[model samples]
Target: MKIGNVNINGKVALAPMAGVADRAFRELCVRFGAAYVVSEMVSSKGISYASEKTISLLTLSECEKPCAIQIFGNDPPVMAQAARFAVSQNPDIIDINMGCPAPKVNKSGGGAVLMREPKLCGEIVRAIKDAVDIPVTVKIRKGWDDNNINAVLIAKICEDNGADAITIHGRTREQMYRGTADLNIIKEVKNSISIPVIGNGDIKSPEDAKNMICKTGCDMVMVGRAALGNPFIFNEINEYLSYKKKLSAPTIEEKVDIMKQHVNSICKNKGERFGITQARRHIIMYVKGLSNAAKLRDEACKLESLEDFSKFCDNILNSI
Candidate 1:
């Protein structure tokens, strides 16, 4: 599938999840066979102020070359400036986050708050598009709320203003992550637009990914929270889509190996001290279905050394 000139070889993609889609997690998904991956939402306002922590989120490695850097904000000129800075990082695409439901983001007049202002959405898209040579895309929810669902209208305005593609999360801003995703809205957006439409929301398994594409007629499907601990979902969905064969889930041993690799990468990127804190949380994700998963989560708080993590992985493998 192609977004403008950028070609993503497969149909399965990793969604740009805030506080979740970090460099380590993104690289894991890419190596495991996610055709596309996006960075966490960057703050346009933060970029304007040159915040180091915020700017660090835009880092893209050589291994993740075809990745996109996503940005969120309210003002047009500030968004344009952010796009310029993001372009310097040499990402394959630039995505505008008009879909985030965080109270902080929305209350500040960014994210899903933009869904209520279709004209501002156009200006923002146009501003970014005009400022960068790379393809520009937008991720959006179905609408602001149930009663004022207007994905089609906002999508049209975005398209008119030069958005190369649109991802339609099938719930309103009001629903957040609750309730079922409405495929009909995604279908309507796909049918209504000429660019590629990526369908998101509630896709937990390979079968769910297939059903989403078949049902919505979307070009690709983006997985968010479903892939938190399970980067293997990308490979599973890709293999199934390509060969009509379902891949087996990871064994306890296999999961441990991946976990160790992920932790090491985090440590190498951040310092050892911060890395332990960062990777400790993911241990619970890896041991999620095991009998002692809850205990593992509590133990995570005290995890201080690589030896501690190694022992934790061994315990899960041995016990489960």
Candidate 2:
């Protein structure tokens, strides 16, 4: 799939998950076979003020290119300014977040709240598109609630306002991440717009990815929560789609090795203290279905330093 000048090699892409889709994780997913990856959502207000933490989040390694940087804010001027800053980082695309259902974001008139007011969403898209030379895209949910599911309307607004692509998560803001994602709603959005539509939500396996595309006719599939501990999902789905083959799951040893590599990268980029703390969640996800996963999670949570994390990982691997 092509988003403007950027040509994605495959149709499976990684959703921009905050806290989970950081630089190290994104690079790992890309290496494993995600056609493209998106950075975690950064705050437009924070970036505008040059907040140190937000700047740290914008740090991109050379390996994760052809990646989009997602920014969220209500104000057109502020969002546009943030888009300009994101361009300086040389991301392949600039994505606006109109899908996040978090209360803090919605109360501020950002995220899915923008979906409530399509005109304002269009204005924001226009501003950001004007501010940056890169292709601009919008990520949105079905709508504010079940009573007002307006993804098609919002998608048309995005395309008309110069957005290069649209990503629909197939659920209302009321649903958040709960319940099943409405594939019917995603199909509606795809039929309503001419630009590329990327379908998201509830995709857990290669067959799920194929079903989403076939049922909705979307140009691409974006995996979020399902990719949490399993970046290999990208390669699995890609291989299935390309060759009609099923790949075996990673072994316990392979999982441990990948987890360690992910930690090392995080440590190299963000230092041991912050990286190991952030890595704790991912480690838990990696070992989630194994026997004694609960015990490993409890022990992993107590981890303090890089050495402690390594030992914890080794213990889990040895136990399995």
Off by over 4 Å in 2: none
TM-score of 2: 0.99
Query: Each candidate's lDDT (Cα)?
Result: 0.91, 0.91
| Cα TM-score per model | 0.98, 0.99
- Residue pairs in clash, model 1: none
Please provide, for model 2 over 177-219, each residue's C-alpha lDDT reduced to its tens digit, 9 standing for 90 to 100: 8999999999999999888999999999999999999999999
- The TM-score of candidate 1 is 0.98
Candidate 1 per-residue lDDT over residues 118-158, each given as its tens digit = 99999999999999999999999999898989999999999
